[model samples]
Target: MKTWILPALGTLVCWGFWAFIPKLTTRYISPMSAMVYESMGAMVIGAIVLAVLHFRPDVSGKGIFLALATGMLGMAGGLCFLFAVRSGKVSVVAMFTSLSPLITIALGYLLLNETITLKEGLGILTAFIAIYLFSAS
Candidate 1:
């Protein structure tokens, strides 16, 4: 019932499914082709959202820049994931890739001065250890 819980849970399930679908898709097409189709799907979803907003978004300079950056990162990550899943174990790749938040945490701490508690630091340490152990197999 918390404000973030629903979206957090939704993300978990959506990404859980998203992780599986790309592996299946990369089987039939190259990463570039898969990315093209994926972008098209995203564009269609964006169009619907724009229609719902009556085609007038906030259009702020900062918001636009961040949105563009997010799209660029998402596209690049998707392309990499597609190429990786084709040649590597999907589970292992997913495990390793999911640790990307460690970068976010470090950036947040350095750039935004977001303090990391001892608990979160331990979690991050554990994640890196797990990644090392998991990949060493």
Candidate 2:
């Protein structure tokens, strides 16, 4: 098997647990409050990762802009997700958001000039339909 499987599964399990936590927190506390604590914890973990890397990662202008954009976009998604779970069914919200790779796929095709095979296109199409049907209820 590929070497990434273990870490990939770890991510899957971690995110599975992550999607559950907000639902639990929103039961007692506000989603915004939960987001406050969650962002703090994430920053601490991010700091640790930086420390472990000895802060050796790229810091060029292009790199900085890309990294900044990534952090901003991810945090925005997290905030939105917290609110989404608070208002909607967790299963529906989670599954719907999980199909976000569709955005990346479309962007890749448009901006990155990436090729999409007919079969992969069909899969993406199916995912879009699934997300729509899942959310429409």
Candidate 3:
């Protein structure tokens, strides 16, 4: 058994909590606002970790641009997810969004010429099935 199993289980629990976050966010605030808050919280935590390690922070122009671009993409995705959850069943939206790994795999294949193993291919297919089953109801 992998020693990482406990951490993986903890992550799954956290992910479960995150699934309902869109609904709660859409109820009380704009998705963009929620994403901004989320990003800020992430940044603060990262900064704190670095500080505790006595690491010097680098705010180069390239780093700033990359961070801004990532934040923009995150905000866009969050808004769309919030809209989906508000307009449809949360379980359906969550299941559909779980297919994001497929997007990542596709991008890696296109940009890096990466090859998918049979197991990964099967996982993608199963994700599709899960999406279809969740959305059909």
TM-score of each: 0.95, 0.88, 0.73
lDDT of 3 by residue, 20-98 (tens): 8778777887776777787787789788989987896667999989988987786678668877887677888888887
Candidate ordering by lDDT (highest first): 1, 2, 3
Local distance difference test, per candidate? 0.92, 0.89, 0.82
Please give the TM-score that candidate 1 achieves against the real structure: 0.95
Output the lDDT of residue 126, model 3. 87
> Which 10 residues in a row give candidate 1 its minimum summed lDDT?
14-23
Model 2: pairs clashing at backbone N, Cα or C within 3 Å? none
lDDT of 1 by residue, 9-113 (tens): 999998888777889998898889999999999999899999999999898999999999999998999899889988998889999999989999999999999
lDDT of 2 by residue, 22-74 (tens): 88889998977887898899999989999999988766998899989998898
Steric clash count of candidate 2: 0
In model 2, the Cα lDDT at residue 10 comes to 97
Regions of candidate 3 where Cα sits further than 4 Å from its true position = 1-11, 53-55, 58-67
Q: How much is the lDDT of residue 50 in candidate 3? A: 93
Error of 2 at 55 (Å): 3.8
Count backbone overlaps in model 1.
0
